[model samples]
Target: MLRRIEMRFLRPYLQEELKSVKMKSQIKFQIGKSGVTEGVIQSLNNAFRTRKTVRISLLQSSGRDRTKMKEIANELGDKLAGNFKHTIVGFTIIMKKTGARKPENKR
Candidate 1:
């Protein structure tokens, strides 16, 4: 399918490979403010104009709530009408299609 992804608040240079996405309407949620994760979440909720899936990218910070990412993911999933996918690496969560493929066994 032809997908249209809107990346919000991201630094305008990060490259993402689009081979994994399976939806036609997808958006990336980027944390543009330097504050707590709650602010970011609020911003996302406030900023979301459409019901498309939103992938959030959190900014790394000291004393940040590690569980906040999970909380946000759960909240978005439960509260949003569209599909919600969360991918966490280090301290950031980028939402994407829920594609799970087990690693092939190499003998």
Candidate 2:
């Protein structure tokens, strides 16, 4: 009886911890000469289903221009479903799925 009670209390905490670990581990994708093609978009969509964060690495052939990177990020954001925001750090683009809901105005 005591063990059952202890497990009941610990279950929620364990689940929360697991979720945090999962979110902390990000999936990585690379963009090569082909650039952000349909395959890449589809792969990112699939990754988002399991992960909250994704790291995209722009390869040398993809070009390292900051302006180009921003454009690619914007393009990906537009094509991807749901609310996803990206941050560009060097040649890596970190995209995170946001779960925030818009506030409804009351009259």
Candidate 3:
């Protein structure tokens, strides 16, 4: 009789736990190229089903456009995941990860 009571009390908690949801982290890479922003955003929408924070790295290029870059970031935040919140971190052209940079030469 005691065991039956315990099982009944445990059932609701178990059900709630079974329905718990988790969000995934998304990382996207876009090498500096022309006409890729729209395509990338479309791909992200099709791929990311759960809420995710995307990190986009823009590699260097000869004709990188700041206006276009801002536009792409804005569209990602406004259109792709407009319902959800996101963050955009922009790096300067030709910037490398600090760890990958060469050590400074001492005079």
Candidate 4:
């Protein structure tokens, strides 16, 4: 009985997660190591202001190794994810925001 209850609760979450993974592969913004700059944080913050998920492609300029990519993900951690919700796959970094986006300029 407990196992059946567990499956019922777990099934939807697993399906949704699979769908998100598929969506993540389709469209993602590209950011370079230069994006690691303070300037890029604002850009990312702005990007999240409008979208729940922001996908970034880390170019060769960002770093050629997975370790550097991990560092970049960590830097985007606090402001981006209060609970460490971001992840890096290959050179791509995916971020998700649950709160409302920031206000856009009128210009």
lDDT (0 to 1) per candidate? 0.50, 0.80, 0.45, 0.63
- Which digits, one per residue and each the tens of the lDDT, describe model 4 over residues 1-107? 53344335545875466347647655466766566666677777776655666777788776667677777777787645333356555456676665556799999
Residue clash pairs of candidate 1 = 55-95
Which of candidates 3 and 4 is the stronger one according to lDDT?
Answer: 4
Tens digits of per-residue lDDT for model 3, 1-107 = 53344335545764343224111233445646563467776766665554233445566672446666566555555656435432223342111111235699999
TM-score: which is higher, 2 or 4? 2
lDDT tens per residue, model 1, 1-107:
11123343233442253223323435655553443356655655554544333556565543346677666567655654345566454455555434346799999
Mind sharing the TM-score for model 3? 0.42
| Cα TM-score per model | 0.39, 0.70, 0.42, 0.60
Candidate 1 wrong stretches, greater than 4 Å: 1-27, 32-54, 60-63, 97-107
Model 2: per-residue lDDT, tens digit, 10-60? 458654643454457557899998998999999999999988788888999
The candidate scoring highest on lDDT is 2
Off by over 4 Å in 3: 1-26, 62-68, 84-86, 90-107
Provide the clashing-pair count of each candidate structure: 1, 0, 0, 1
Provide the RMSD of all predictions against the true structure, rounded to 1 decimal: 12.2, 12.3, 19.9, 9.2
Q: In terms of TM-score, which candidate is strongest?
A: 2
